[model samples]
Target chain A: MSSHSTRRGVASVMTSSTYRPASAAEARFLAEYDASAYATPLVTVDPVIVTLRDEQLAVLLVKREEHPFLGSWGLPGGFIDIRNDADPEACAVRKLKEKAAFVSPYLEQVKTVGGRERDPRGWSLTVLFFALIAEDDVPPIDKRLAKWFPLSALPDAMAFDHRALIDCAIRRIRAKAEYTALPAHLLPQRFTLSKMQRVFELVLQRRLTAGAFRRRIEPLVEPIADCFETASHRPAQVYRLRPDSGSLIFEQPLKGARRK
Target chain B: MSSHSTRRGVASVMTSSTYRPASAAEARFLAEYDASAYATPLVTVDPVIVTLRDEQLAVLLVKREEHPFLGSWGLPGGFIDIRNDADPEACAVRKLKEKAAFVSPYLEQVKTVGGRERDPRGWSLTVLFFALIAEDDVPPIDKRLAKWFPLSALPDAMAFDHRALIDCAIRRIRAKAEYTALPAHLLPQRFTLSKMQRVFELVLQRRLTAGAFRRRIEPLVEPIADCFETASHRPAQVYRLRPDSGSLIFEQPLKGARRK
Candidate 1:
């Protein structure tokens, strides 16, 4: 193959013309560099709150009140308080409580999105986070402009790059669910196996054979003493994730290999 | 447990005293906000080049020539040229070529790490990337400042949070290798099964049985016509990754379930 075979040491790489260290004058210039020379983008934190509502996968969104897609729906988020919050995650938690008056049981830093004219308010960088809350735990919107939209059918336009952020969160959650206990975050403390199966189906956007799913998750969960009985249906077993299990990844072979 | 029950919408949240939007006057003030108003952290990108050398996992690092940890080894990286590069990934590829005269076959945006005091040059944010290169493809270092250090035994002193960055990359690569075919990136275009298995063992820090590994990868790779033979050893078969197997994730059950 076309591969370089030179086995030079670090000294040679560091002293080369392209990778040379800064001169004394250049070092001074960098040390005294005025950050205000160019407009620095405002860094913000945005979160996609995902939940199961009316048997549909939904996301929490808020209406933008200012210019640049004003009155359009967007993820519930705000500018991070750099002074008060310790990190981007802290900022996400604070913003969610302040703007949505909600707290998510599971929160994770998904990714960061910047550039591509994401915002009209000069240059901007946004750290995106995803939070999964149980449907029963979703509090009523404290404001008139916030609402839950189906993930599969979002509005035509959203504030900034909120649409892309939501899509990223959905894909990440689905991929993570395949291996992690992330779906547990979307279930109540006590849930029936059927209830959980429905949540899984909603999040994954596909139907799963109950027998296959149970076989797949048999070791991942433990049956509790409690049971849920409906008026029209018989008592179903209740289950909770095994306390010892921390992200149990079940590897299913590729489709092509299934023939074997 | 203690969950909020309010059903307010966006208007209520936005208009609330705690979550008010920036008013016209406040907007004007923010528009004119100067970088000197607060300590704005410098943003930089650092890359971790992981490879196998002499049957040991190693990473590329360079000695810092400046005052902060001068003469200490650190990941080869530099401040982002945002104007020239579209994103952090582009900046990482550029830095690698300049610093080591090396181009990786696979480069992925692993994660971003930032904190107030992460850098001695005031507050700083760093976007970290991990790249995988075959040992034979490593080019000669153009400068004398770069070197490869064993991952298990790095130097005592490193600049900034370089040590933590390296640890993060290792964990991510190891975890990813468990479910994804990322180990393929560490091997040459054409390699023997034994060579491929060794790369996996180095990254995962574990020994996998040859029969088990071969069965697991049977569908992932296809046999090639080439073979390597020596007087002391029989001809070893060669193989290559199948073109259709992109990011094949095999479901290996958790260890606790393996007993069953």
Candidate 2:
């Protein structure tokens, strides 16, 4: 290891950098520097867990038990536990497990909302993350603590800027669905092509021609030979996503049907 | 106005919600709720100011004057002054102005970086943003305080996870350039088609077919009739972005010329 490797500083995480040891003057400044000298912003992580509830695209929300908005519905999240959580994403994962009892869902950061007046406590910021759980994979939960609400019909009262947060998440999903196999995360590991198309339509809230969708989806999925034996007797063929389909990107969007 | 209209809480900023006033029991809880009871994580805002310097795409970096990584290069950003900045974007804009003398460049949040070990002080979080300044509109600056480095060859020594931050920002810009009119922001309000193409090539690091590029860009730009006074007698034409071109997205990616 190099001499500067022992000294922990900013360039530690990034590769391809030669860090130089601090000089004596810098060490004196560091001794005087206080981490808590300034008022730090209240940072939190919010995970908007999403799944299909009764064929409708819905997001999970928890009942607030705190003073800011007691009894109000809010996204499943709270302040990051600095003692255990290493990063915002780690905090989001822990929140998902603690508040909703969900585990290992496909989560992606969507946006960050920060300001002085967002939370009544003080200047605050929250990283917004959206998690997708297959409709059939949703575990049992107590309705009084948390419940799923369709994107179209949320409760009359919500806490913080959650309404905007959910709207942006849905917008991101819709945009990705046009050119990527993102909607596959909302279905069973093995599903019919028709079901995959339906999930895409549900998330995108539009009708797609089969020929067009198939042309776009063919490269992203593969037919299961075992399912083919049974599906051959049936109508719809069953398929699973290709290993790299999760990151697939098409050059063009799946064109929607013309207006009636 | 509703009876609860005066209540300032979580739902204050979001529109379309029936917010009920807190109950007497909740008010008691708020009285004892300490805003600073928990250790708040250190939060900051970073703006990666990008421009075309000497015919190459470059990002502005400042010389650190403080202890950690003292005298090292970093992005043009800093902590959000909670007393003044209303949101993270506002803080990013302020940092751009304070550090680089840049005012109101095209700013957009690209990502957020946070962890306990990223900073030596304590658990910290930072929102990452990238701003685009037109090559012709770049203001003069003091080299001692800040300097621009081409993306291909950055300084050997840097601060924090800035390399990853910059890579992510450039990836976002390249991905958007494929289908949207994002490259226009890298040039002056008015430019020739060739100059626009050059900017796109410099950003994407690839050559595009002239015929294909013009077809995709035509609807997003308008030829200047005034310039026709002399351009009518010339081979090339000058154009300006359309009013709504900033958000314009094509159905397909710009086609790059096939490799020989």
Candidate 3:
């Protein structure tokens, strides 16, 4: 049996006449297309907003007010506004602003999720984005539906494949943390090395030695001269991401037990 | 002015009556949705099929047979068969088979590109995938249009934003080559360390010292007793990816002019 015969055809509904290409060749090609050749799937941008809270990673989720998954919790997302936004990242940032009333300095497209059984309506494709924000800057929540839940104490059931999406995002963060300064996205502008080490431990869920971590991080960051005085302790030296740091690739921070 | 007012709404054309959810509560919810609430964009899966040829990176592109850039070269792709395929990867593999009659051993989802202007047929989203195959194993071309073009000498005109897509794939391959054992995908089942280093140089466009390259690759590969005699030299040791190597992350292979 041929795979082509077994596969169902996707119907197209795009009318080519509406598009006005810059070039005459492109315009001629568009004018000759079969507009209804294939069916388009619904695409959405879903952001997994995360931050460090109480020495643990936390994710922000909103409760669904309407049907489909009424009262069920899910990641804050919406259909991409194709007419207004230039790209998926813009659509995701807009969704973040609309749903969470927060702006993230660091947002990276992590993965794309699509399947026949993922949605109840029809075929839907969601581009998952990993967004990290500082804990202190989390905006005031006016909408009663949104809340930050610690990773350890997540809700029993999420609206869709959100639990899996969160898992993927965490994996990306931890994997990236090995070579890149990803935890900086979750910390404040200037922070102590001790504070940064805590962020790594929270994300990796493993305690790392101070000396080893300092050696790993020393080249990636530069001293700021300014000191941060913690309550009941002497001032600790603060550091910031180096000006020349460009996705600084290094050896894995924590390794299999080596010579001490 | 509210940003919401300026954003164009996505129309939902998914008929609720056709969907029959497993859960009674979910079934009730799906039946109640107004299908026309949002508009969905056309989603596609575009795979960049890459192989090493003549110590250079080559990409496989098929000439467009139908309208919407007819006769022009583009990455082999098709509208996702949402009803039949289980996921995007399956859709990509199917498209690859249909267009190039190629089956890749290593395939990974790279990125998702979406916007209003990406497709001349209206708003569309394309999930880009990176697929690598051995040069000798490439299937015989039954279609007259498909051809492998060196990355340095691409055609002047490519369908859609395929040029940008190719550039993105190259960037990802180079960035990933710094940490992971990704080049193994482009080589045969077993190979010499010298042959593997050449693949790296081709992808990264840089010359690496033998000692340094070997040191970086030591942990990721396992040596085989079998060896292949070269034209002018003795037999060289062969290696393959370690059984336990899972996206093996390592330190940057080359540093600034190390010990000349």
- What order do you get sorting by DockQ, best first? 3, 2, 1
A161: Cα error in model 1, Å: 1.8
> On TM-score, who's better, 1 or 3?
3
**Candidate 2 TM-score to native:** 0.88
Screening candidate 2 with a backbone cut-off below 3 angstroms (N, C-alpha, C), the clashing residue pairs are none
**By lDDT, is 1 or 2 better?**
2
Chain A TM-score per model, please list them.
Answer: 0.78, 0.86, 0.83
Model 1 chain B poorest 10 in a row by lDDT? B1-10
Per-residue lDDT of candidate 3, residues B1-260 (tens digit): 10111112322333323445646776776666433334456678899989888878999899877656778899988777655556788888887777777664567899998876678766678989987788877767656757999999999989989999999998998888877778878878788888888888777777778888888888888888766647546778888888887777665544322455
TM-score of each: 0.81, 0.88, 0.87
Please give the DockQ score of every candidate, comma-separated.
0.10, 0.27, 0.31
DockQ of 3: 0.31
Tens digit of per-residue lDDT, candidate 2, span A1-260: 10111112422232112333378775565455444445556678888888987889999999887667877899988887666677888888878677777674868988889876576656678999887789778888667678889988899878877888888888888887876778888988988888888888999888998888888888989998766425456766679888977577875778877779
Interface RMSDs of the predictions, in order, are 15.8, 9.8, 9.9
Which digits, one per residue and each the tens of the lDDT, describe model 1 over residues A1-260? Answer: 10111113212221112222235654564455443333333467788988887887899888866554567888877664434555667777777776667765467878766552565443346778888888888877767757789877899977777888998988998988766657778898777777877777777767767776776677778888756556446878788888876766654411111222
Give the C-alpha miss distance for residue B40 in model 3, angstroms.
1.4
lDDT (Cα atoms) of all candidates against the true structure: 0.67, 0.75, 0.74
Between the candidate structures 2 and 3, which one is better when assessed by lDDT?
Answer: 2
Task: Report the lDDT of model 1 for residue B236.
Answer: 78
Tens digits of per-residue lDDT, candidate 2, B127-167, equal 99887789788888677678889998897867777777888
